[model samples]
Each structure stands twice: as C-alpha cells, then as structure tokens.
Target chain A: MLQIKNLKATIDGKEILKGINLEVKAGEVHAIMGPNGSGKSTLASVLSGKPGYEVTGGEVIFEGKNLLDFSPEDRAREGIFLAFQYPVEIPGVSTTNFMKTSLNEIRKYRGLEPISSVEFLKLMKAKAKLVELDMAMTSRAVNVGFSGGEKKRNEIFQLAMMEPKLSVLDETDSGLDIDALRIVSEGVNKVRNSKNAFVVITHYQRLLNYIVPDYVHVLSDGQIVTSGGKELAYKLEEMGYDWVTNND
Target chain B: MAELKDKIIEKYTSTENLNNGEPVEIKHIRDKAKEYFRTFGFPNRKMEDWKFFDSKPIITNDFKLVTEKQEIEKSVLNNFLIQDLKANLIVLINGEYSKENSQIITERKNLFIGSLKEGMKTKPYILGKYFAKYADYNADGFTALNTAFAPDGAFIYIPKGNLLKDPVIILNILDSRKSKVLGQPRNIIIAEANSDVHIIEEYYSIGENDVFSNVVTEIHTDENANVQYYKIQNEEANAFHVGTTQVFQERNSIFTSITLSWGGSVTRNNLNSYMNSEGIECNFKGLYFLTGKQHVDNHTLADHANPNCNSNELYKGILADESNGVFNGKIMVRQDAQKTNAYQMNKNILLSDTASINSKPQLEIFADDVKCSHGATTGQIDKEQLFYLKARGIGEKEGKKLLIFAFANEIIEDIEVPELKEYLVNRLNEKLEKL
Candidate 1:
C-alpha cells in the first residue's frame, strides 16, 4: 500500500531522515517507535508532503503513484491522511464546515458527486460518535479552545470521516491520558479493515497495547536500526534504547 | 489649491438660486464653510491627520463639482436594493433627492423622513439646531468642502418616546455616465429623548467614469436614545469616497456605527463620537475588503468628556493584490470623565506580497480613573491554519477563500439587521471569488 525508498530528508540544512526504507501492505498495521529527536515526526511530515521539509534524495510511492509529484493538498485528495501532532486552532471555521469542505473536495478529485446536506449531517453524526465527540463540538471553531484529549479524539473523527487509503498517526498518543488513549486507539481499531492500512508513530509502547501492530521498527539517529515483529516493542520497552541499540 | 478653490468660489457666488428658499442663517453658514475651505485648501500628506491619505488624485482629476441631477429609471435601482429589506426608501440621484424614485412607507405625526432641503423648510427649528453642528469644517478640508456645498441629502428625525420599527435606507447613487461627477451630500439625523432608530446609507456608482462622493453626517442622540448607523459602500472601482460622520451622545445614550467598504479607488472615512454626558455607550466597527489598486483609510476618534462612559472600536481588513489599507484610532478621556472605559483593536490580512496595511492607535487620557487598551495586527493568512484545511482534502484555493471569508466574517456577524446581514454575506462571498 505504501513504499519509501532511500528516503533522505532535511530541514534547514540538517538532514533528519538518513536513507530509511520501509514498506507496508494493505490490511496490515506497522508501528514506528523512537526516542526524542529520532526523525519519527519528520518521516510522517515527508510522507504527507509538508512544506519547508526538503527531500534531499528520496522517492515515496503511494498506491503505485509517485507521491512527491503531488502538492500537500493533492496528497490528501489522493487518500494520504496525516494526523498532525498538534492540530492548529482555526477560529471562525466550524468543524462541521471544515469536514464538509474537505469531503466535497476529495469527492470531486475522485470524480464523485458532492455529498448532499442530509448525508453529510448523517455522516458527521455517525463518525463523531465513534470518537465519543459531542455534537456541540462540531459547531464550534475547529480546535479552538479544545482540550488536548478532545483534539486527539477530533483527529480520529477526521480519520474516520476521510477513510483514506493510508493513515499516518503521528504522535497521536503523546498528550492523551489513559482513558483518551483507549478511546482514540479503539476508534482506530474500529475503522481498520482489510482494504486500508495505518502506520502508527509513537514514542512509547502504551498505545500499542490497544492497537497491536503487525510489525515493529525502532528508529534511531534518522535510520531504522532494527526491525522485528510485535516482540520488538516489548523488548525495547523493557530494556530501553540503550539495550536495544547495544544488542543490535 | 488656488485653481479648485477659485473655481468653487466662482461657481458658489455666480450660481443662481443656489440658496433658493434657504434660510439667511444657512446661506451665511455656507459662506463661512466656503471661506474655511479656501484657507485650508485640500488636505495634503503634509498634515498629520492626512499623513496617510493623499488627495492629489481628487484635485488633479478636475471632476465636475456641480453635477446635474440625472433621471434614472426605478428598475435601474432594482439590482442594488437589499433582497428582503422592507424599509422607508430614499433615493438620491447625484446628491439630490428624487421624489419620483423614493418611497416613504412609514410615517408618524412627529417623525420626519425626507430630504434635507425639504426638512430645512418644514422643520426649520430642528435643522437650525442640528445642521453644521457636530462635524468639524474648520479642521477637515473635505468636511469644509462638503459643508460649503451642503446639497440635498437624506434627513430623518425620530420623535421622542417612539421606536422606529422600519429602518430608513438611503441609496446615494452617483451617475457618471457622461463625465466625471463629484457629489457633496450632507445628512442630519436627530433622535429625541428615549427614541430608537436604525439608518442605513448605501453608496453606489452607476457609471464607468470617475465618481467622487464627499459626504458628512451629523447625528444627535438625546438622553437614553439608541441609534444604529450602517454604511455599505459598494462603489465602482474608479470611485473616490471621503465620508465624515460625527455623533453626539447624551447621558445614558447608546450609539453604534458600522462601515463596510467594498469598493473605490481611494476611500477615507472619519467617524467620531463625543460622549458629552454621563453613562453613554459608543461603538465603532468597520470592515474593508479591497482588491486591485483599491486604497482605504479609516480614521476614528472617541472622546469621553463626562463620567461613566464607555467606547469600543474594532476594525478589520482583507487586502488582495496591490491594495492598501490604513487605520488610525484615537481615544481621548478628559479630566472630568472618570471611570471611562475605552478599548480599540484593528486587524488586517494581506493576501498578496505587495498588499500593504498600516495601523496606529492613539490614546490620550487625563482622567486618573479611566481604563483604556488598544491592539493592532497585520499579516498574511496563517500558514498553520491554511495547512490544516488543506490537509483535510480541501483544495488550496478553496481553503484560502474560506479562511479569508472567516477572517472578514468576524465583522459581518455583528450586523443588527437580518436582511442586511444576509445581503452582506452574499456580497462577501462574491468578493471572495475574485480574491
């Protein structure tokens, strides 16, 4: 479903991702874990085509298409969704309106008719409940004055709404409490299917307990130093990065 | 300076019946205003008040100051009327009242809604007391020029203890079909004690030629009176507009002014309010959405002369292309005006690289028990916000348009009238398409 070949990225003349390669098939979940400043977020940003991040030498292929040729907005319309680490507060734009705009945009790109108002409201109500979001929250400005947990849940709501081909959860569990983590992870699990894939990026093994990954990879100093199954997550969490790197 | 001034004086003295049926007092007042304009000439960039506004374009254009009244069909105005508004309509063709075009649907015994020229003859006492009273002609050149001409304009008076249910809509249309036309319209609105009223002034340029509208409005609110004033400027791209609205608030009175500037080549607005008595509330709100080479400047002042008064001012702008936007808001709290509260804020968004915005807030406080705060900000649309929208599958252009509309919606949401608000929302959407 997604392929990264020799992905070398830089920001402000400093290379962040150094020759990292990864691949994931449909119906599978991959978890990328790393310590602080190990290019975990940079990888997600590069995959989503964020501005200001220069891909020095790399090519990202998503569903047989060269993703680098598309703009950030185009990437989203092509079913590449990146749940931001920190969702920005946009005043005066209701969350429902935001959802409507993006849904119609994606539909247009896919040669589908725009969603009707009745269907939109029904979809919003259904998806909003998956994350336990209040109907009132959708009427307020997007992310304005939202709590940290509410923001995370809102991100999951968007993930459910878009139903993208490849979803990158970048640090979605960082600021969440135990309850919020369970809810957010459970929401992701409900949306998981054999036709779609998710790449969970996190700094800890706590979120993995809820949404188990098919494979686990440890990223250190801008490269994937070790790759293994779910046992790798338990070993790294038990012995720490020092033991994991020394053993590798 | 000499050329325009001499020509105006030549025409002011030689024109027959310019003062026909006009009171002797009004004629003397006109002469004084003309003399004042002659001395000050036109406001240049050298003057502090006119530092950011340049009147050179208006002076060099040689627009005909004396525009003849043009006969326009009623259907010609159908395109500009508010869709669902039911109000007393007063139409002015080139600054003169057109009885054939205006409609007065609501009338009371003590209420007066008609032209200033007729109001002066019918209610001389009211006109004699309120006309040429609050607005300053001595310091402002355009005010002086407008006062000198003081042509026919919309005049409305609400009697004491009466609530005006229907708002008065004044359509000031500039007919520049044949040549450059300059209009000077003076408006006076007096709300007696405990009266409430709403007035809307909408300006439009009908032709492609150069059109200039120099307008001055004087309003007086007696004790406990409430007045809502709205100005919707949808002029042509080749239009130049200078408007001055002076308001006086008595004890326990409330006055609110909102301006929406959507057109013109160069536009400058001056809105001032004097809280002369205790416990007055004053508000000034404006929004300007400009594209192309449009330039707009808004200057406002809130003077608190008595105790226990409050004034709040907020103005926002969205500038696209190489347009320019400017704002200067002054808050003055006199020594005797204790416990006064004054707040001011101005914000702007520049869509293109060349678009410019300038804002300055001035506060002078001599009262020890006063509170005042002001803030200003100018920048491009927030990148993080825009990216968030784009990441949701919305296209770049659609996201940008939405953000711009939301930015300007903060001002439009404060409109008190429902139909007007709906109309403005549609107008804003149309303007955003071009941006």
Candidate 2:
C-alpha cells in the first residue's frame, strides 16, 4: 500500500530521517519503535506533507502515485490521515461542524454528493460510540478544555469517521491511561480491514499488545537498524534499544 | 479652519425660521451648541481624544449642507430596508424624514415614531427635556457640530410600562449625487420606567460623490427599563461618518449596545454610557471588518457613578489590504461607586502585513472595593490553527475563512435577536469570501 525509497528529510539544516526505507502491504499492521529524537514523528510528518520540512533526497509512493507532488490538503484528500500527537484547541469551532466540513470536503474530492444532515448525524452517533466519545463533547468547541485521554479518543473518532486508506498513528498512545489505551486500541482494531493499512509509531510495546503488528522495525539515529517479526518487539522490550543499536 | 468655520456660520445664519415654533429653551441650547462648534472648529491630532483620528479631510472638503430633500425612487429606498424584519421602518433621506417611505405601528398608544422636527411640534415638552441632555457637546467637537446642525432624524419614545412589539429600524440614506454633501442626523430615544425597547440605526449612501455624516443619538432609560441598541454602518467607500451614541441609565436599568462597522473611507464611533443610579448593568460590544484602505476608529466609555453597577465591554477588529483600525476603551469608577465591577477587552487580527491596529484599553478606578480589569491583544491569523484546518482536507482559502469567521463568531453569538444575528452572519460571510 505504501513504499519509501531512501527517505532523507531535514529541518533547519539538521538531518532527521537519514536514508530510511520501509514497505507495507494491505491488511497488515507495522510497528515502528524508536527512542526519543529518532525521526519516528518526522517520518509521519513528512508523509503527511507537513510544512517546514525539507525532503533532501527521497521518494514516497502511495497507492501507485508519487505522494510528494501533492500539497498537504491534496494529500489529505487522497486518503492519508495523520492523527496528530497534540490536537489543536480551536475555540468557537464546534467539533460537529469541523467534522462535517472535513467529511464534505473529502467527499467532494471523491466525486460524491454531500451527505444529508440526518445521515451526518447518524454517522456521527454511530462512529462516536465506537470510540466511546460522549455526544455532549461533539457540541463544544473543538478540543477546548478537553483532557488528554479525551483528545486521543477524539482522534480515533475522527479516524473512524474518515475511514482513510492509510492511517499514521503518531504517538497516539503517549498520554493515554490503561483504560483509554484499551478503548483506543480496540477502536483501531475494529476499523482495520483488508483494503486498509496502518503505521503504528510508538515508544513502548504496551500498545502493540492490544493491536498486534505483523512486523516490527527498530529506528535509531535517523535510520531503521533492524527489521523482524513481532518477536523483535518482545526482544526490544526485554533488553531495551541498546541491544539493537550496539549490534548495528 | 477659518474658511470652514465661516462657511458653517454662513450656512446656519442663512437658513430661515430654523427653530420655528420651538420653545426659547431649545433655541438657546442650539445657539450654545453653535458657539461651541465655532470655537472648536474641528478637532485636530493635538487634542488627546482626537490624537489617533484625523479630521483633516472632513474639515478641508467643501461640503454643502443638504437642506433640500432629494427625490429617490421607491425601488432604491426598498433596497435599504431589512427585507425579512417585521419591524416599524423609519426612513430618512438626505437628513430629512421621508413620510411617504416610513411605516409606523400606530396601534400602540404612547409610542411615537416620526421625524424629530414633527416631534418638536407635537411633543415639545419631552423633546426639550431630553433632546441634547445626554450627549455632551462640550466634550466632543463632532457632537457639538451635529447638535448645531441638528435638522431632522428619527424620534422614538416609548411610554411608561410599555413593551414595543417590534423593533424600530432607523435607516439614514444619503443621496449625494449632485454635489459633495454634509448630513447631521440627531436621534432621541426615551424609554420610560418599566419599559422595554430595541432600536437599530443604519447608514447607507446611494451615490459615489463624497458624503460626510455627523450623527448623534441620545437614549435615556428610566428606572428598571431595558434597551437593546444596534448601530450598523456600511456606507460607500468614499463616505466619511462620525457617529456618537450616549446612553443614560437610571436605577436598576439595563442597557446593551452592539456597533458593527464594515465599510467606509473613514468611520469614527464614540459610544458612552453613564450609570447614574445603583444596580444598573451596561454592556457594550463592537466588531469592525475593514479592507481596501478603509479606516475605522472606535472610542467607548462606561462611567460607573453609583454603587453596585457593572459594565462589560468587548471590541474586535479585522483589517485586510492596508486597512487601519483604532480602539480606545475606558472604564471609570468614581469614589462613591463602591462594589463596581467593570471588565474591558479589545482584540484585533490583521490579515496582511500592511494592515495595522492601535488598541488601548484604559481603566480608572477610584473606589478601593471595585474590581476592574482591561486588556488588549493584536495579532495575525494563528498559523497553527490555519494548518490544523487545512490538514483536514479543507483548502487554504476555506481554512482561513473558517478561522476568521470563528474569531468573529464570539461576538456574533451574543446577539439576542435571531433575524439580526442571521443577517450579520451572512454579511460577515460575504466579507470573508472577498478576503
């Protein structure tokens, strides 16, 4: 579903992602575990076409098209979703209105008619339950005064609503408690299908236990040093990242 | 200054029977106001209150006082009316009341809706009691000028214990097609004890020729009265307007005002409210969106004179394409006005690098037991908020538009009238689309 060839990215004249390459197929979950400042979040940002990141030398192909040619909004319209590590608090913009606008824009890009108000309400209700989001939260301003767990759950709620082709969970489990982690991981597991793919980026092995990955890759010092099956995650959890970095 | 002063004196003295059938008291007041204007001529940047606003163009331009009423087609007049509002419409053309175009709800007793000149003839006692009482001619040059040339405008009076079934829509239309014209519209609204009323005052210019409007409105609220007032200014791009609104609140009275300015070459608004008695509440809100070399200045004041009075003030400005805006708000708590609560905030967003704003929120509290705070903020469109919206598949234009709308919506949501709120929302959207 996605391919990266020697992905080299820099920000402010400092190299972050140094010749990183990875591949993912349909219906598979891939876990990219790395220490702090190891370019895990940079990979997610570059793939999502975030501003202020200069791609020095690399190419990213998604679904048989070069993704670098599209703008951030166009990339979003092409079904690339990046759940932000910290969702912005937008006062005076209700969550329901934001979701409706986003959904209609995406639908327009796909050559589909706008959803009716009744159907939109029903969809919101159904998807909100999958993430256990309270209906009252949707009526308030977007993420204003929301707790950490609620913000993460709202991201999952958006994921369920968009139903994108490729989803990048960028540290989605950083601030979640045990209960919230279970609920968020369960929500992600429910949304997985044969036509979709996910790149779960985290710092710990706790989330992989809930949403098991088919492959695990160790990212250290701006490159992927080791790639193996799920057992690699257990080994890293048992012996920490030094085991792989020293071997490399 | 001398040339303009001589022209104004000639214009005032040349008119015949200017105060026909008026009492000697009103004539004396008019004479005093004229003397005040002659002494001040026009305010300059040297004055403290007039430092930010320059009246050079208004003073230098040769403006003919519009004495004769001009003819306007009914179709043109209908365009200025609020189409969906079921309110009493009072239309003034070239500073004169147009009887043929006005509609008054006459079934309600003790509700007066007509021209100020006619009101002077019929209800001279009430007009004389509160005509130029609230607005201080000595403090402001524009107020003094408007009072000196006070010819004709809307006169609204609601009697004691009466509730107005519909709002009063006062539309001032200027037809400056033949020559550069000057218009002074004086409005007086008095709500008696235990009464409720809503008034919406708007301005429109039909022709491209320069039109300078000097308007003053004085409202008096008796004990336990409630009044909601709105001022909408969307004149032509070449039009210059200076409007002053002074409201006086008695014991336990409630007064709220919202001033919205969208278009004009130079627009200056002075809104002041005096809380004379205890347990009064005064709220002032304003929003101005300017583009294309437009300049708007808003100066507001809330005077808490008695004990246990509260006032809240919020003003927002959005400037784009080299537009300039200024906001100066002051809250004063006198020595005897203990337990006073006053809050003031002014916020601005500049869309372009060339656009600028000067905001100053001042608070003077003499009473030691009062709680008063004021703040002002000026910034550009938040980039993180913009990126958040754009990353959700919304285009850059739509993203910026949404953020701007959201910023302005905080004030729009405070409007109590549904129709007016919806109208403002549509107008704001239209303005955002152009930006």
Candidate 3:
C-alpha cells in the first residue's frame, strides 16, 4: 500500500529523517515506536506533505503513484490521512459542517454527487456512535475548548468519517488515560479492513495492547534499527529502548 | 471647499416653501444648525476626530440637495424590503417618507408609526422634546449638515409598558437616477418606560450616479425599556453614506446596536450611547467587509455616567483588494460611576498586502472601582488555520472564504432578529465570494 525509499528529509539545514526506508502491504497494521526526538513524528509529517520540510533525496510512492508530486490537499483527496498529534481548534466552524465540507470535497474530486442532508445526518449518527462522541459536540465549534481526550476521540471520529486508504496515527496516545485509550483503540480497530493500512506512531507500548499491530519497528536516531512482531513491543516496554540503541 | 458650501446655501435658500408651516422651535434649530455649518465648513484631517477619515472626496462633489421627493415604482420598492417579513415597513424615497409605500398596524393603540414630518405636525410637543437632544450638532460636521437639511424620515413611538409584537423596518432608498443628489434622513425613536422595541434601518441606492446619504438617528429609552437597533448599508458602489446614531439610556434600560457596512465607496458611522442612570446595559457591535477602493470608518463611544452600569463593544472588519478601514472605539466611566464594567474589542483581517486597517480602542476611567478593558488587533488570515482547512481537501479559495466567514460569524450570530441574521449571513457569504 505504501513505500518509502531512502527517505531523507531536513528542516532548516538539520537532517531529521536520515535515509529511513519502510514498506507496508494491504490490511497490515505497523507500529513505529521511538523515544523523544527520534524523528517518528517527522516521518508522519513528511508523508502528509507538510510545508517547510525539504525532502533532500528520497521518494514516497502510494498506491502506484508518486506522492511527493501532489500538494497536501491533493494528497488528502487521494486518501492519505494524518491524524495530527495536536488537533487544531477552528472557532465558529461546527464539527458537523467541517466534516460535511471535507466529505463533499473529497467526493467531488472522485466524480461523486454530493450527499443529501438526510443521508449525511444518518451517516454522522452512525459514525459518531462508533467513537462514542456526543451529538452536541458535533454541532459545536470544531475542537474549540474540547478536552484532550475529546479531541483524540474526535480525531478517530473523523477517521471513521473519511475512511481513508492510509491512516497515520501520530502520537495518538500521548495525553489519554486508560479508559480513553481503550475507547480510541476500539474506534480504530472497528474501522480496520483489508483495503486499508495504518502506521501507528507512539512513544509507549500501552496503545498497542488494545489495537495490536502485525509488525513493530523501533526508530532510533532517525533510522529504523530493529523490526519484530507484537511481542517485541512488550520486550521493549519491559527492558526499554536502550537494549537496542546501546547495541547499535 | 467653498463651492460645495455655496451650493448647499443656495439650495437651502431656494427651498423655503418646503417648510412653510414648520413649528417655530424647529425653524430655530435649523437656523442654528446652518450657522454652525457655516462657521466650521467641512471637517478636515487637521481635526483630531477626523484625522484618519478624510472628508475631501465626500464634500468636493457638487451634489444637489434633494428638496422634492422622487417618484418610485412600487415594484422597485418591494425589491428592497425583506421578503415575507411580517413587520411594519416604512419606506423613504429621496429622504422623504412615502405614505403610500408604508404599512403600519393601527390595531395597536399605543403604537405610533408615520413620517417625521407628519409627527412634527401632529405631535410637535413630543417631537420637540427629543429631537436633536442626543446627537450634538457642535461635535460633528456631518451631524450639523444632516440637521440643517433634515426634512422627512421615519418616526416610531411606543407608549409606556407596550412590547411590540413585530419589528419595524425602515428602508431609506436614494434615487440618484436623474442627477447627483444628497439625501439627509433624520429619524427619532422613543420607547417609553417598560416598553420593548426592535428596529432595522437599511440604505439602498437605485442608480449608478453619485449619491450622498447623510442620516442621523436618535433613540431615547426610558426606565427599564429595552431596545435593539440595526443599521445595514449596502448601497451602490458610487454612493457615499455618513450615518450617526446617538442613543440615551435612562435607569435600568437595555440597549443594543448592530451596524453592518457591506457596500458604498465611502462610508462613515458614528455610534454613541450614554448610560444616564444606574443598572443600565449597552452593547455595540459592528461588522464591515470592504473591497475594491472602498473606505469605511467607524467611531463608537460608550459613556457611563452613573454607578453599576455595564457596556460591551465588538467590531470586526475584513478588507481585501486596496480597501481601507478604520475603527476607533472609546469607553468612558465618570467619577461617580463606580462599579462600572466596560469592555471593548476591535479585530480586523487584511486579505491582500495592499489592504490596510487602522484600529484604536480607548478606555478612559475616572472611577478607581471600575473594571474596564480594551483591545485592538489587525493581521492577515492565520496561516495555520488556513492550512488546517486546506489539509482536509478544501481548496485555498474555499478555505480562505470559510475562515473569513467564521471570523465575522461571531458578531452576526448575536443579532436578535432571526430573519435579519440569516439575511446578513447570506450577504456576508456573497461578499466573501467576490474576494
């Protein structure tokens, strides 16, 4: 589903992702674990085509197309979703309206008719139930004055709404408690299917217990030093990242 | 400068028969206003109050003062009124109220709605008590001009303890199809004790020729009365408008004013409210969206005279192309006005680098026990907000339009009238699309 060949990225003359390479097939969930300042978030940002990041000498291919040539919005229309580490608060824009606009825009790019109001409401209700989001929260401004757990849940709600082909969860478990983590992971697990893929990035192994990944990659000093299975996360959690970084 | 003044004087002298049976008090006020205008001529950039707003383009043109009312077709008048609005409609053609175009509910005994001229002839005693009382002619050149040439406008009076069921919409239409004209519509609204009323005033020009509309509205609210006033200016691009709204609030009265400026080449609004007694509340909100070479200036003042009064002010502006905007808001708390709470905020978004805004929020407090705060901010649309929207598959243009609409929606949502709020929202969307 996605391929990153010798991904070399930099910001302000400082290299962040140093020749990182990764590959993912359809229906597989990958977890990229690292300590602080290990360039995990940079990989997600580069995949999402954020501005001010210079791709020094690498290429990213998504679904048989060169992703680097597309703009951020075009990449979104092409089914690339990046759940932000910190969700933006857009005042005066209701979450319902925001989702409607985004869904319609993506549909328009794919030559689909706009959804009817009645159908849109039904869809909203069905998807919101998956994440346990309050109906009142959808009518209020998007993420304005929302709690940290609510924002994270809202991100999952959007993921359910968009149904993107490739979803990158960047530090989605940062500020969540145990209950919130369970609910959020349940939302992600429910939306998983054979046609999609997920790149879960986290600093800890707690989120993996709920939405278990097929493969685990330990990122250290801007490179993926080790790759293993689900048990590797528990091993790293018990011993710590130094077990791999010290030997490397 | 002298040529425009000479033209006004000539027109005033030639139209003597227009006010043949005017009351003696009214004639005296007119003469005094004329004298004041002659002494000061037109306000210049040299004056501190008129520094940012230059009056050169407005006063340089040789505009003929409209003395006779222009005939307008009923179909043309219906286009300006809100469709399906169940409110009393008062239409003014060329600054003169058209009785044939107005609809007033006579079943309400305490309600009085008619032309100002008719009100002067029928109830001159009541008109004389509040006319030119709140708007000081000596303070503003435009106020003096409107007073001297004031002939006819809308007059709304509600007796004590009467709550109006329907809103009153006053539509002022300027027909400059024949010549370059000047229309001054002077309005007075009086709400008796314990009464409630809502008013919506709008300006519309029918022609593409140069038209100057100078309007003054004075509102007097008695004890415990509630009033909501809205002023909407969406005239032709060749039009110029200078509007002054002065409100006086008695003990425990509540007053709210919303000013929306969407069109016109040069627009200036002076909105002032005076809280005379304790426990009074006042709110002043404004929104302006300008493009092309348009210029809009807003000056607002909230004067707290007694203890335990509160006032809030918020004004937002969106400037694109080469448009220019200015916002100057002042809140004053007198020495005896202890426990007064006042807040003022002004925000502007500039779309193009050539677009400019001058925002100034001032607070003057003589009472040490008062709580007062003021803020002014001017900047371009936030890049992060824009990118957030764009990253969701929305285009740059649509993203910008959405953000700008959201910025202005904060004030638009506060409108008490549902229909008017919806109307302004549509108008704002249409304005933002052209940008």
* lDDT per residue as tens, model 2, B1-435: 446567888878777457687766777788888889878877889988888897888888888875577767899987777767888888888778889888887446767888898899889999988989999888867888888777888899999998886898898888888888788889999999999988999999978688889999999999999999999998989799999999999999999999999988999999999999999999999999999999999999999999999999999999999999999999989999999999999999999999999898989988999988899999988878777777788778888888889999988898877888898899899999898
lDDT of 1 by residue, B236-300 (tens): 98899999999999999999999999998999999999999999999999999999999999999
Instruction: Give a tens-digit lDDT track for model 3, residues B1-435.
Output: 456777787777766556656677777787878889878877889887788886777788888776466778989987787766688888888888988888886447746888899888877888888888889888877899888878888889989999987899899999988888788889999999999989999999988678888999999999999999999998989889988999999999999988999989999999999999999999999999999989999999999989999999999999999999999999989999999999999999999999999888989989999899999999998877777776678777887888898999998998877888888888898888788
TM-score of each: 0.98, 0.97, 0.98
Per prediction, fnat is 0.79, 0.60, 0.58
Residue pairs in candidate 2 whose N, alpha carbon or C atoms collide under 3 angstroms: none
Better of 1 and 3 by DockQ: 1
**What is the TM-score of chain A, computed separately for every candidate?**
0.98, 0.98, 0.98
Interface RMSD of each: 0.8, 0.9, 1.0
lDDT, candidate 3, A46-146, per-residue tens = 98888888999888999999999998888889998888899899999999988898898889999999889999999999999998888899999999999
What is candidate 2's lDDT per residue for A26-97, written digit by digit as tens? 899999999999999999999988888999998999999999999888888898888889988999999898
TM-scores of chain B, in order:
0.98, 0.98, 0.97
Q: What is the lDDT for B313 in model 2?
A: 93
Q: After superposition, how far is residue A39 of candidate 3 from its true place, in Å?
A: 1.4
DockQ of model 1 vs. true complex: 0.81
DockQ-derived CAPRI band for the predicted complex in model 2: medium
